[model samples]
Target: MLTTSTRLKLQNICSRLAQGEFVSLQERVYLQKFAERDRSVSTWVSRAQRFQREGTQQGLDGLMADLDLGRRNPDDPEHPEDDLGDWFSNASPWLRRD
Candidate 1:
Protein backbone atom coordinates (compact mmCIF):
# COMPACT_ATOMS: atom_id res chain seq x y z
CA MET A 1 0.00 0.00 0.00
CA LEU A 2 1.16 3.50 -0.82
CA THR A 3 1.57 6.02 1.92
CA THR A 4 -1.04 8.77 2.00
CA SER A 5 1.51 11.45 1.10
CA THR A 6 2.80 9.46 -1.82
CA ARG A 7 -0.70 8.86 -3.10
CA LEU A 8 -1.44 12.58 -2.82
CA LYS A 9 1.69 13.50 -4.68
CA LEU A 10 0.86 11.00 -7.40
CA GLN A 11 -2.58 12.52 -7.71
CA ASN A 12 -1.04 15.97 -8.09
CA ILE A 13 1.22 14.74 -10.85
CA CYS A 14 -1.70 13.08 -12.59
CA SER A 15 -3.72 16.28 -12.30
CA ARG A 16 -0.97 18.29 -13.92
CA LEU A 17 -0.60 15.68 -16.65
CA ALA A 18 -4.30 15.80 -17.36
CA GLN A 19 -4.03 19.54 -17.78
CA GLY A 20 -1.25 19.17 -20.34
CA GLU A 21 1.43 20.49 -18.05
CA PHE A 22 4.92 19.06 -18.28
CA VAL A 23 6.38 17.14 -15.40
CA SER A 24 10.09 17.16 -14.59
CA LEU A 25 12.26 14.12 -15.25
CA GLN A 26 12.50 13.51 -11.53
CA GLU A 27 8.71 13.50 -11.23
CA ARG A 28 8.48 11.13 -14.18
CA VAL A 29 10.96 8.80 -12.54
CA TYR A 30 9.04 8.99 -9.28
CA LEU A 31 5.84 8.06 -11.04
CA GLN A 32 7.60 5.27 -12.87
CA LYS A 33 8.91 3.79 -9.66
CA PHE A 34 5.49 3.72 -8.01
CA ALA A 35 3.76 2.60 -11.20
CA GLU A 36 6.02 -0.41 -11.40
CA ARG A 37 4.86 -1.51 -7.97
CA ASP A 38 1.18 -0.54 -8.16
CA ARG A 39 -1.25 -1.58 -10.85
CA SER A 40 -3.59 1.31 -10.18
CA VAL A 41 -0.76 3.81 -10.45
CA SER A 42 0.34 2.19 -13.69
CA THR A 43 -3.14 2.50 -15.11
CA TRP A 44 -3.32 6.13 -14.02
CA VAL A 45 0.01 6.86 -15.63
CA SER A 46 -1.05 5.20 -18.89
CA ARG A 47 -4.31 7.14 -18.96
CA ALA A 48 -2.39 10.34 -18.33
CA GLN A 49 -0.07 9.52 -21.20
CA ARG A 50 -3.02 8.80 -23.46
CA PHE A 51 -4.56 12.12 -22.51
CA GLN A 52 -1.32 13.84 -23.46
CA ARG A 53 -1.30 12.08 -26.80
CA GLU A 54 -4.98 12.43 -27.70
CA GLY A 55 -5.63 15.87 -26.14
CA THR A 56 -9.08 14.70 -25.16
CA GLN A 57 -10.28 15.22 -21.62
CA GLN A 58 -13.48 13.27 -22.19
CA GLY A 59 -11.66 10.10 -23.02
CA LEU A 60 -9.41 10.49 -20.01
CA ASP A 61 -12.39 11.18 -17.78
CA GLY A 62 -14.18 8.08 -19.02
CA LEU A 63 -11.09 5.96 -18.60
CA MET A 64 -10.47 7.30 -15.09
CA ALA A 65 -14.09 6.66 -14.19
CA ASP A 66 -13.65 3.09 -15.34
CA LEU A 67 -10.78 2.85 -12.92
CA ASP A 68 -13.00 4.10 -10.08
CA LEU A 69 -11.05 7.30 -9.78
CA GLY A 70 -12.66 10.74 -9.66
CA ARG A 71 -16.04 9.11 -10.10
CA ARG A 72 -18.83 11.69 -10.17
CA ASN A 73 -21.38 9.54 -8.52
CA PRO A 74 -21.39 6.71 -6.05
CA ASP A 75 -25.13 6.04 -5.96
CA ASP A 76 -25.82 6.45 -9.65
CA PRO A 77 -26.27 2.68 -9.88
CA GLU A 78 -24.41 2.47 -13.17
CA HIS A 79 -21.76 -0.21 -13.36
CA PRO A 80 -18.45 0.73 -14.92
CA GLU A 81 -18.93 -2.17 -17.34
CA ASP A 82 -21.99 -0.38 -18.67
CA ASP A 83 -19.59 1.99 -20.45
CA LEU A 84 -17.14 -0.64 -21.69
CA GLY A 85 -18.60 -0.46 -25.17
CA ASP A 86 -18.05 3.26 -25.34
CA TRP A 87 -14.60 2.87 -23.88
CA PHE A 88 -13.63 0.26 -26.45
CA SER A 89 -14.97 2.36 -29.25
CA ASN A 90 -13.04 5.39 -28.05
CA ALA A 91 -9.82 3.47 -27.44
CA SER A 92 -6.67 4.40 -29.31
CA PRO A 93 -6.62 3.14 -32.86
CA TRP A 94 -3.64 0.94 -32.19
CA LEU A 95 -5.59 -0.78 -29.48
CA ARG A 96 -8.42 -1.70 -31.82
CA ARG A 97 -8.56 -5.03 -33.67
CA ASP A 98 -10.00 -3.55 -36.83
Candidate 2:
Protein backbone atom coordinates (compact mmCIF):
# COMPACT_ATOMS: atom_id res chain seq x y z
CA MET A 1 0.00 0.00 0.00
CA LEU A 2 1.17 3.51 -0.82
CA THR A 3 1.85 5.95 1.94
CA THR A 4 -0.49 8.93 2.11
CA SER A 5 2.22 11.38 1.12
CA THR A 6 3.36 9.24 -1.78
CA ARG A 7 -0.18 8.89 -3.03
CA LEU A 8 -0.68 12.63 -2.84
CA LYS A 9 2.53 13.31 -4.71
CA LEU A 10 1.56 10.78 -7.35
CA GLN A 11 -1.86 12.38 -7.78
CA ASN A 12 -0.26 15.77 -8.18
CA ILE A 13 2.17 14.55 -10.82
CA CYS A 14 -0.57 12.69 -12.68
CA SER A 15 -2.78 15.78 -12.52
CA ARG A 16 -0.06 17.82 -14.17
CA LEU A 17 0.26 15.15 -16.82
CA ALA A 18 -3.48 15.34 -17.46
CA GLN A 19 -3.15 19.06 -18.04
CA GLY A 20 -0.50 18.44 -20.69
CA GLU A 21 2.15 20.12 -18.60
CA PHE A 22 5.78 19.14 -18.90
CA VAL A 23 6.97 16.82 -16.14
CA SER A 24 10.66 16.89 -15.45
CA LEU A 25 12.82 13.80 -15.68
CA GLN A 26 13.32 13.79 -11.91
CA GLU A 27 9.60 13.65 -11.31
CA ARG A 28 9.27 10.82 -13.81
CA VAL A 29 11.96 8.89 -11.99
CA TYR A 30 10.16 9.43 -8.72
CA LEU A 31 7.00 8.14 -10.30
CA GLN A 32 8.86 5.12 -11.59
CA LYS A 33 9.91 4.28 -8.04
CA PHE A 34 6.31 4.06 -6.91
CA ALA A 35 5.27 2.33 -10.09
CA GLU A 36 7.60 -0.50 -9.26
CA ARG A 37 5.39 -1.28 -6.28
CA ASP A 38 1.99 -0.58 -7.82
CA ARG A 39 0.86 -1.83 -11.18
CA SER A 40 -2.04 0.61 -11.23
CA VAL A 41 0.38 3.53 -11.17
CA SER A 42 2.26 2.10 -14.13
CA THR A 43 -0.96 1.59 -16.05
CA TRP A 44 -2.14 5.14 -15.46
CA VAL A 45 1.25 6.57 -16.33
CA SER A 46 1.22 4.68 -19.62
CA ARG A 47 -2.27 5.95 -20.37
CA ALA A 48 -1.22 9.50 -19.54
CA GLN A 49 1.76 9.23 -21.87
CA ARG A 50 -0.38 7.89 -24.67
CA PHE A 51 -2.94 10.64 -24.31
CA GLN A 52 -0.23 13.24 -24.19
CA ARG A 53 1.48 11.78 -27.24
CA GLU A 54 -1.82 11.75 -29.12
CA GLY A 55 -2.57 15.35 -28.06
CA THR A 56 -6.03 14.35 -26.89
CA GLN A 57 -7.43 16.56 -24.17
CA GLN A 58 -10.59 14.47 -23.91
CA GLY A 59 -8.55 11.35 -23.31
CA LEU A 60 -6.62 13.15 -20.61
CA ASP A 61 -9.79 14.20 -18.85
CA GLY A 62 -11.03 10.62 -18.91
CA LEU A 63 -7.78 9.48 -17.44
CA MET A 64 -8.11 11.99 -14.62
CA ALA A 65 -11.65 10.88 -13.89
CA ASP A 66 -10.56 7.27 -13.78
CA LEU A 67 -7.78 8.17 -11.41
CA ASP A 68 -10.09 10.05 -9.13
CA LEU A 69 -12.47 7.14 -9.11
CA GLY A 70 -9.65 4.69 -8.35
CA ARG A 71 -10.36 2.75 -11.50
CA ARG A 72 -7.60 0.82 -13.21
CA ASN A 73 -7.32 -0.70 -16.65
CA PRO A 74 -8.40 -4.30 -16.65
CA ASP A 75 -5.48 -5.26 -18.82
CA ASP A 76 -2.86 -4.01 -16.34
CA PRO A 77 -0.77 -6.82 -15.00
CA GLU A 78 -1.64 -7.94 -11.50
CA HIS A 79 2.00 -8.73 -10.78
CA PRO A 80 4.86 -6.32 -11.37
CA GLU A 81 7.15 -9.23 -12.24
CA ASP A 82 4.90 -9.99 -15.16
CA ASP A 83 6.07 -6.84 -16.97
CA LEU A 84 9.60 -6.39 -15.60
CA GLY A 85 11.27 -6.49 -19.01
CA ASP A 86 8.92 -3.89 -20.46
CA TRP A 87 9.46 -1.64 -17.46
CA PHE A 88 13.23 -1.87 -17.74
CA SER A 89 13.21 -0.95 -21.44
CA ASN A 90 10.90 2.00 -20.86
CA ALA A 91 12.90 3.21 -17.86
CA SER A 92 16.12 3.42 -19.80
CA PRO A 93 15.24 4.95 -23.13
CA TRP A 94 18.59 6.72 -23.22
CA LEU A 95 20.42 3.44 -23.78
CA ARG A 96 21.43 2.65 -27.37
CA ARG A 97 21.57 -0.63 -29.27
CA ASP A 98 24.93 0.17 -30.80
Every candidate's lDDT: 0.76, 0.69
Q: Which runs in model 2 stand beyond 4 Å of their true positions?
A: 55-98
Clashing residue pairs for model 1:
none
Clashes within 3 Å, all models in order:
0, 0
State the displacement of the C-alpha of residue 87, model 1, in Å, after optimal TM-score superposition. 24
For all predicted structures, in order, the TM-scores are: 0.56, 0.51
Kindly list the per-residue Cα lDDT of model 2 for residues 35-94, writing each as its tens digit: 887987877676665555544445766676545433334345663334556656667557
Q: How accurate is candidate 1 locally (lDDT)?
A: 0.76
User: What's the CA RMSD for each of the models?
Assistant: 12.2, 12.9
Q: Which residue pairs overlap in candidate 2's backbone?
A: none
